[model samples]
Target: MSRAITSETKHSIISDFKEITKIRLSVSVVFSSIAGYLLGVESVDYNTLILLALGGYFMVGASNAFNQVIEKDLDALMNRTKYRPVPAGRMSVNTALIIATIFTILGIVILYTINPQTAMFGAISIFLYTCAYTPLKTKTPLAVFVGAIPGAIPFMLGWVAATDDFGIEPGTLFAIQFFWQFPHFWAIGWFLFEDYKKGGFFMLPTGKQDKGTAVQTIMYTVWTVLVSIIPVFGVTGRLYLTPISGVIVFILGLGMLYYAIQLYKKMTVLAAKQLMLASVSYITLLQIVYVLDKFIR
Candidate 1:
C-alpha cells in the first residue's frame, strides 16, 4: 500500500511539472527554433541542434512557468486558466519560482555551451517575456508588440546558436517570424477577447475587435506574406526561394489573407477561430516551404 501511494504521488508531481512548463507550448517554440537553425546553418550539426532544442525548451518553459506564477491571481478568475496547476492549488508559488529559476539557469548554461550570443539572446527572451511582457499584458494593448520580440526570437535564436553571430540570414529569419506574429496573435486575441477581458488583458489593438483591429490584422497579414516571398528575389544572399516555391508561398499567403479578410468582414467568434487556425497553418506551411526550397534549390 505504501509503495502504491508513493507511485501515485510521483505521478502527481510529474503531472504538475508538465502543467507548469506547458509542454505543448514549449514544444511548439522548440520546433520554430529548430526550423530556424536548419534554415540558417550551411551544414547541419546534430550536436548543435540537440543543444539548441534543449536550450530552447528550458528557456521557453521557464518563461511559461514564471508567467503562470505572476498571473496566478488573475488566472483563477478565468475559466480557461483557472484549472492551471499554479492557480488550482496543485503547486505552490515558491515551488514554481524555484523550478522556473533552475530551468532558466540550466537553459542559459546549455546555450552558452553552444555559443555566447545564443545564450545572451535566450536570457533576453526570458527577461523580456517574463519581466516585461507579462506585467504589461493588463496595462496596455502594446504588450503584444513587446511579447512578439521574445516570441519571434526563437526562430532567429537557433541561427545565432549555430553561427554564434548576428547577420543578414538570422535577420531575415527574424523579420519573417516577427511579421508573422502580429496576424497570428491578433486572431487569437479576437477569438479569446472575452477570456482576456476577464483577466484585464487588453490584447486587441483598439481594445476592441472592431474595424480598426481587423484592418490591422489584414495589414500585418499582407506584410507577412510579402516578407515570406522576398527570398525568391535572390536579394537575401544565401537564403534563396526559387520562383516555383515563391509562387506556392504566394498562394499560401493569399489563402491566409482570404481568411483574414473573411474575419474582418464577419468579425464573429467563428470567423476569428477560422482565422486563428488559418494563421497557424500558414506559419507551419511557410516554414516547411522554406526548408524544402533550400534543399531542392
Candidate 2:
C-alpha cells in the first residue's frame, strides 16, 4: 500500500510539473525554434540542434510558468484561463515561481553552452515576456506590440543558436514570424474578446472587435505574406526561395488574406475562429514551403 501511494504521488507530481510548464505552449514554441534552426543552419549539427531545442523549450516554458504566476488573479477572473494550474489552485504560486526560476536558469545555461548569443536572446525573451508583456496585458492594446517582440524572438533565437551571429538570414526569419503574429493573435483576440475583456485585457489594436481592428489584422496578414515571399527573389542572402516556391507561397498568403477579409466583413466569432485557424495553417505551411524550397532548388 505504501508503494502504491508513492507511485500515485509521483504521478501527481509529474502532472503538476506539466501543468506548471504548459507543455502544449512549450511544444509549439519549440517547433518554431526548430523551423528557424533548420532554415538558418547551412550544415546542421545534431548536438547543437538538440541543445537549441531543449533550451528553447525550457525558456518558453519558464516564461509561460512565470506569466501564469504573475497573472494568477487576473487568470482566475477569465473563463479561458481560470482552469490553469496556478489559477485553479492545482499548484501553489511559490512552487510555480521556483519551477520557473530553475527552468529559466537551466535554459540559459544550455543555450550558453551552444553560444552566448543564443543565451542572450533567450534571456531577453524571458525578461520581456515575463517582466514587460505579462503586466502590460491589462494596461493597453499596445501590449500586443510589446508581446510580439518576445513571441517573434524564438525564430531568430534559433538562427543565433546555430550561427552565433545576427545577419540578413536571421532577420528575414524574424520578419516573417514577426508579422505573422499580429494576424494570428488578433484573430484569437477577436474570438475571445469577451473573455479577454473579463480580465481587462486589451488585445486588439482598437480595444474592440471592430472594423478598424479587422482592417489592421488584414494589413498585417498582407505584410506577413509579402515578407514570407521576399526570400524567393534571391535577395535574402543565404536564404533563397525559388520562383515556383514564390508562387506557391503567394497563393497560400492569398488564402490567408481571403479568410482575414471574410472575418473582417462578418466580424463574427465563427469568422474570427476560422481566421485564427487559417493563420496557424499559414505559418506552418509557409515554414514547410521554405524548407522544401531550399532542398528542391
Candidate 3:
C-alpha cells in the first residue's frame, strides 16, 4: 500500500511540474527557436540543436513558472488560470520559485555554451517577461506590447545561436513574430474579456470587447501579413525567400487575415477563438515554410 501511494504521489508531482512550467507552451516556443536555427545554419549541428532545444525550453519554462508565481492570486480569480499549480494549491509558491530560479540558471548556462549573445538574449527575455510584462498586465493594455518583445526573441535567438551574430536576418525574423503577436493575443483577449476582467487585467485596447479593439486587431493582422513577406524583397540578407515561397506565405497570411476580418464582422467569442487558432496555425506554418524554403533553395 505504501509503494502504491508513493507511485501516485510521484505521478501527481510530475503533473504539478508540467502545470507549473506550462510544458506544452514551452515546447512550442522551443520549436520556434529550432526553426530559426535551422534557417540560419549552413549544416545541421545536432549538438547545438539539442542544446538550443533544452536551453530554450528551460528559459520559457522559467518565465512561465515565474509568471505563475507572480500572478497566483490573479490567476485564482480567472477561471482559465485558476487551476494552475500555484493558484490551485497543488504546489507552493516557494517551490515554484525555486524551480524557476534553477531553470533560469540552467537555461543561461546552456545557452552560453552556444554563444554569449544567445545567453544574453535568453537572460533579457526572462527579465522582460518576469519583471516588465507580468506586473504590467493588470495596469495597462500595453503589457501585450511589452510581452511581445520576449515572446518574439526565441524565434531570432536560434539564429544568433547558429551565427553568433545579431543582424538584419534575425531582426526580420523578430519583426515578423513581433507583429504576429498583437493580433494573436488580442483575439485571446477578446474571447477572454470577461475572464480577464475578473482578474483586473486590461488586455484589450479599450478594456472591453468593442469596435476599437477589433479595428486594431485587423490593423495588426495586416502588419503581420506584410512583414512576413518582406523577405521576398531581398533586403533581409540571408533570410530572403524565393518568389514562390513568398507567394505561399502571402496566401497563408491572407488565410489568417480572413479570420481576423471575421472576428471584426462577427464580434463574437467564437470568431475570436477562430482567429486565435488561425494565428497559431499561421505562425507555426510560417516557420515551417521559412525553414523549408532555406533548405530547398
Candidate 4:
C-alpha cells in the first residue's frame, strides 16, 4: 500500500535533493568562474553570465553527486557524512545517478553555447574530480594534488569561457588557486583527521597531521602569498592589481599565514579548524580583491 506523501515530506525530500547536490559549494564554484569570466570580458553580457553560472553550478553539482554515490558506503561510517542523503538511505543510488547524469548533460550543453573550449574544460573538471580524485582519496595523499587540478580550473575556466584562449593570464590565475589548495584542504584534513580516517580517507599530506604536514602547509601558504601578489607586477595581461590592492592581497595572505603558523605551533584540532576558516576567508577576500582591482584600475 502506498502512503500519500505530505507537503512537509515533499519539502524534506527537496531539501535532501539540494543537500545531495551540495548547492552551497556549487554556488561558490560558479561565483569563482563568473569572476574569471568578468575579468576576461571587455563588457559583460548579463545573459551569457547567467547561463555560465547555471552551467557551472550544474556541472559542479553533478560531480558532487557522483562523489557521494561513489562514497556512499564510506560516508555512512564517518560522523560528518553519515547523515548525508545517500548515506542516510533517503536517496537511492539509482535516483542520485539519474540526477547526476541529467545535470552533466545540461551543464555541458549550456557551457557549449559559450564555446567548445569552455565546455571541454567543464567536462574535464568533472572527469578529473570524479574519476581521478574521488577514488584516489582513500588510496593516497596524492589525491589532493589531483583534486587541486580540477579545483583550480574554475578561475581559469572563466577566462577561457570569455576569451577561449589558454595563455599566461589564465595560467597565472590557475597557479594562484592551485597552490592555494594545498594549505586550504590540508587544514581541513588536519582538523578532521579522525573523522576522515573513519571513512578510510587519508587526506593529510603525510597521511597524518604531523610536523611534516605543518611544514608543507607553511611552504604552500608562502607560495600562495607570493603568487597572490604577482599580478600587481603586470605580467598577467588581463589581471592587473594596483599597488593598493596588492598590499591588501598581501595582508589577507598574511592573515591566512598567521593561522597556518598557529596550526604548526599548536598542532591541535582547534588551531587546525581556525586555519580552515582563515583559508576560506583568504580565498573569498582574494577573489573579491581581484574583481575590485580589475575595476579600480
Candidate 5:
C-alpha cells in the first residue's frame, strides 16, 4: 500500500509539473527556434542544436510558469485557465517559483554554451514576457503588441545562435514573425474574447471582438503575407527564398487570410477558431517551405 501510494504521488507530481510547463506550447517555441537555427546553419552541429532546443524550451517553460504564478487569481476567474496547476490547487506557489527559478538558470546557462547573443535574447524574452507583457494584459489592448516582441524573438535568436551576428537576415526573420503575431493573437483574442474579459484581458484592438478588431486582423494578415515574400527579393542578405517557394508561401498566407476574412464577415467563434487553425498551419508550412527551399533550391 505504501509503495502504491508513493507511485501515485510521483505520477501526480509529474502531471502537475507538465501542467505548469505547458509541454506542447514549450515544444512549439523550441520548434521555431530550431527552424531558425536550420535556416542559418551552413554546417549543422547536432549537439548545439540539442542545446538550443533544450534552452529555448526551458526558457519558455519558465516564462509560462511565472505567468501562471502571477495570474493565479486571474486564471481562476477564467474557465479555460481555471484548471491550471497553480489555479487548480494542484501545485504550490512556492514549488512553482522554485521550478521557474531553476528553469531560468538552467535555460540561460545552456543557451550561453551556444552563444552569448542567444542567451541574451532568451533572457530578454523571458523578462519581457513575464515582467511587461503579462502584467499589461489586463490593462490595455496594446499588450499584444508588446508581447509580440518576445513571441517573435525565437526565430532571430536561432540565427544569432548559429551565426553570432545580428544582421539583415535575422532582422527580416524577426519582422516576418513580428507582424504575423498580430493576426495570430487577435484571432485567439476574437474567439476567447468572453473568456479574456472574465480575466480583464484586453487582447483585441478595440478591446472587444467587433468589426474594428476584425479589420485590424485583416490588415495585419495582409502585412504578414506581404512580409512572407520579402525573402525572395534578395534584400534579406543570407536569407533568400526561391520564387517557387515564395509562390507556395504566398498561397499559404492567402489560405490563412481567407479564414481571417471569413471571421471578419461572420464574426463568430467558429470563424475565429478557423482563422486560428489556419494561422497555425500557415506559419508552420511557411517555415517548412523556407527551410526546404534553403537546401534544395
Candidate 6:
C-alpha cells in the first residue's frame, strides 16, 4: 500500500535535516571565517564574501554531520546528545553519510574557486576533524587539542582566501583562536563532566574536574589573552591594532580572565558554566572589535 506524506511529516524531515547538519553551529563557524576575511581584505568583495560564507558553512556542516555519524552510538549514551537526529532514529547513518559527502564536495569546489590553498585547507579541516579528532574523543583528553586545530582554522582560512598567502598575520589569527579553545572547551567539559562520562569521552585536561583541571584552564585562559593582544605590539605585520583598540581588547581579555579565575577558585559547575558563556561572548566580541577597529581607523 502507498502512503502519502503529510505536512507534519515534511516539516519533521526538514527539521531532521537541519539537526543532522548542525545548522546553527555551522553558521557560527561561517561567521568566524567571514570575520577573518574582512580583517585580511583591503576592500570587501561581496561576491567573494558570499562564496566564503557558503563554502565555510558547507565544510563545517559536513564535519558536524560526519561527527554525528561517527559518534551516534556514543551519543545515544549521553543525555546531551541522545536526541540528535542519527541517535534518535530520525536520520540514518547512510543518509547522514550521503549528506556529509555532498557537503564535502561542494565545500571543496566552492573554496577551490577562491584559491587552491583555500580548498586545501578546507579539505584538511574536514579530514582532521572527522578522521582524527572524532575518534580520539574516547581515548584521550588530548582530543580537545586535535579538535582545536580545525576549530581555529576558520578564522585564518578567510585570511588565506583573501590574500592566497600564509604568513604571520594569518598565523597570529590562528594562534589567538587556537589558544582560546582550551579554556573554552575545558569549561564546557567541566560542566558536562557527568554527561560525558556516560559516553566514555574524556574531554578535561586532567581527565576529571579537579584542581589540576582548573589550574590548566586558568593557564590556557592566560595564554589566550596574551596571544589576543599581540597585534598591538606592531610585530604581527599587517595585523597590527591601534592603541585604543588594543586597550579595548586587553580589557575584554581581562573580563574573560576574571571568569577563569572564578572557576579556579570555586571549582564548581556553576563557575564553569559562567566561564563557558564568558568565553563564547569574548570570542564573538573580539572578532567584532578587530573588524570594527580595522574599518573605523
Clashes of 6: 0
Alpha-carbon RMSD to native, per candidate: 1.4, 1.7, 0.9, 1.9, 1.1, 1.9
TM-scores for all predictions: 0.96, 0.95, 0.98, 0.97, 0.98, 0.97
Worst 10 residues of 1 by lDDT: 161-170
lDDT of candidate 1 over 193-277, digit per residue (tens)? 9998999999999999899999999999999999889988888877788999999999999999999999889999888888888
Worst 10 residues of 5 by lDDT: 24-33
Clashes of each: 0, 0, 0, 0, 0, 0
RMSD of 5: 1.1
lDDT of each: 0.91, 0.89, 0.95, 0.91, 0.93, 0.94
Put the candidates in TM-score order, highest first: 3, 5, 6, 4, 1, 2
Q: What is the C-alpha local distance difference test score of candidate 1? A: 0.91
Query: What range of 10 consecutive residues in model 4 has the weakest lDDT sum?
Result: 1-10
Give candidate 3's root-mean-square deviation (CA, Å): 0.9
Residue 165 in model 2: shift from native, Å?
1.4
lDDT of 2 by residue, 94-213 (tens): 989999999999999999999998899899999999999999989998888888888888887877877888999989888988899899999999999999999999999999989999
When sorted by lDDT, best at the front, the candidate numbers are 3, 6, 5, 4, 1, 2
On residues 1-297, what C-alpha lDDT tens digit does candidate 5 reach at each position? 999999999998888888899998888888889989999999999999999999999999999999999999999999999999899998999999999999999999999999899999999999999999999999999999999999999988889989999999999889989999998999999888889999999999998778999999999999999999998989899999999999999999999999989988999999999998999898888888989999997
Residue range 104-125, candidate 6, lDDT tens digits: 9999999999999999999999
The better candidate by TM-score, 1 or 2, is 1
Best by lDDT: 3
Candidate 4 clash pair list: none
Task: Report the error of model 6 at residue 75, Å.
Answer: 0.5
What is candidate 6's CA lDDT for residue 7? Answer: 70
